[model samples]
Target: MNLYNLNPKYRILVTGGAGFIGSNLCESLLANGNTVVCLDNFATGKKSNVTPFLSNKKFTLIDGDIRNLSDCHKACEKVDYVLHQAALGSVPRSMNDPITSNDVNVTGFLNMLVAARDAKVKRFVYAASSSTYGDSKNMPKIEDVIGKPLSPYAITKYVNELYADVFSKTYGLETIGLRYFNVFGRRQDPAGAYAAVIPKFVMQLMNHESPHVNGDGSFSRDFTYIDNVIQMNIKSLVTNNTLAVNTVYNVAYGKRTSLNELLDLLKEYLTEFDLKIGSVKTTYGPIRKGDVPHSLASIEKAKELVGYNPEYNIREGLREAVQWYWNNLK
Candidate 1:
């Protein structure tokens, strides 16, 4: 799909626009000549992420919390579309603090949906989680078949799908849910206890520190690239296909790589920058709670429905991510 082929400029509202995924979306949208309104509380979002866009006349930054209904309403004003990316995103974080997770992921999500519906936006595309595929040993996860949620975070995301479905039926709001897998790339933070595995490993290996493997290095994930995710979100917004609305799609690379394989790739890439990184060994620990053994995506549904053709695989995406880290973070 050609991202630049979008016909008319749109006024888009991206919640959590100061966060990794949201910031990337904002950059892409602005490059494509669209006006962007970003809503972020800076709780988990960093100001450095959106700092570059501060000078853009087409960009507006709203320092607000998604937990507050007024902030949601304020962000949705005069916006054509809403890409809802705001949420507390770590499984372990949710397991530790279920109340806050529910309040943000579930209640905050509801606030966005209500604001979008009330504002009469053209579409509402929110971030969903692959964690919702809990306990279903399905090799290539499809959209229809989902198991019970394994954690409070997963529970909240699943409830988002339910609420979005209800809103589409009850209020006729156009909605789509992108169930993202282990998405990683440039600007993804490498610090914090809840940092994603790819960035964490890259940061650790860069510092000549041994990164810990949560299991016997057997667990695998469909490590999707941020560019592929951007394609999906843009397609979700501009697609005129009637069948594409009010549904969820798997946003992933449609391939899985084990932690052992992943670590090897990181070392191989980082070693090019510093030979010592190759010698950094890994420390293995017991599997963490609320984690599945494997995750792969059946992106066929997305391919068939929304014309989603992912542009990057694991190695291609990883190499790019490594280069980005080496240039920007190192």
Candidate 2:
């Protein structure tokens, strides 16, 4: 049974729709008979990521940046909903250049919000981050309780939540903020300074090179799969529960996996393709600046409110993702 059947077809606008998560969302929505408009400047997003969708009659690509209010306004024209995913990611990158990060993540976010409000979209769902729980020593992070942001990137995301709340209250715009925890899956880029751990490690192991562990490998995260995130976004879009609107939810698998455990699982999966990969070792490095020691989300609120039932845990997601990289990128 298609769980998304309850929702009516919508003309959705996905900012940063050429990026990893946005591209996946556009693909799913288009598959389900919805019209999708993708707005991207291609700063961090690649044109190749969206090339496959160009022929789709339902997909429209807008070559524009969110930093420009007119561009955001143009993208929001007649759109039913907005899934704002475009932003400069990576704490280290933000630390190095806080100005650009603030411009794209903060100012750009505000532009999207104003556009959505003017367009009168049914709902505005934006990607928040687990880094919002920065510096908090909590084991399982709850949505309501968050620690002060430790980095400029974290600060920008936290500010997004604040802005969303204010917009919902002041402008009567329906909004939902999803604080994603370590999302990884297909189309996730593996070649970048700020590449995510799963794809980065998979690429390294495939090349028979030693993967670098940022810490003792004991640091853990509640890694959520991209499909699960897509589900949450869909649910947020269609949920009739008024309580679910105008609130934030932690989108995660509700389980924690250490970096060491993750590497071991990667080896197990990739070794089936090439047995020599099993012998590849990992090199340890100093802990990264602005990195949280541990992260685990309490998804009780998401489940009770938005009916979020994640379909994949870490191992299941990794199996699918590893196979994707092996077949496509390797």
The alpha-carbon deviation from the true structure for residue 299 of candidate 2, after best TM-score superposition, in angstroms, is: 0.4
How high is the lDDT of residue 67 in model 1? 93
User: How does candidate 1 fare on TM-score?
Assistant: 0.99
Model 1: per-residue Cα lDDT at residue 50: 95
lDDT, each prediction: 0.94, 0.94
Q: Against the true structure, candidate 1 has what lDDT?
A: 0.94
| Candidate 1 deviant stretches above 4 angstroms | 1-4
- For model 2, the superposed segments whose C-alpha errors exceed 4 Å read 1-3, 6-8
Candidate 2 lDDT over 1-330, as tens digits, reads 243763436799999999999999988888887889999999888899899999999999999999999999999999999999999999999999999999999999999999999999999999999999999888799988888899999999999999999999999999999999999999999998989999999999999999999889999999999999999999999899988999899999999999999999999999999999999999999999999989999999999988899999999999999999999998
Best by lDDT: 1
Q: Write the per-residue lDDT of candidate 1 for residues 1-330, one digit (tens) a residue.
A: 236366447899999999999999999998888899999999899999999999999999999988999999999999999999999999999999999999999999999999999999999999999999999988899999999889999999999999999999999999999999999999999999999999999999999999999989999999999999999999999889999999999999999999999999999999999999988989999999999999999999899989999999999999999999999988
Sliding window of 10 residues with minimal summed lDDT for model 1: 1-10
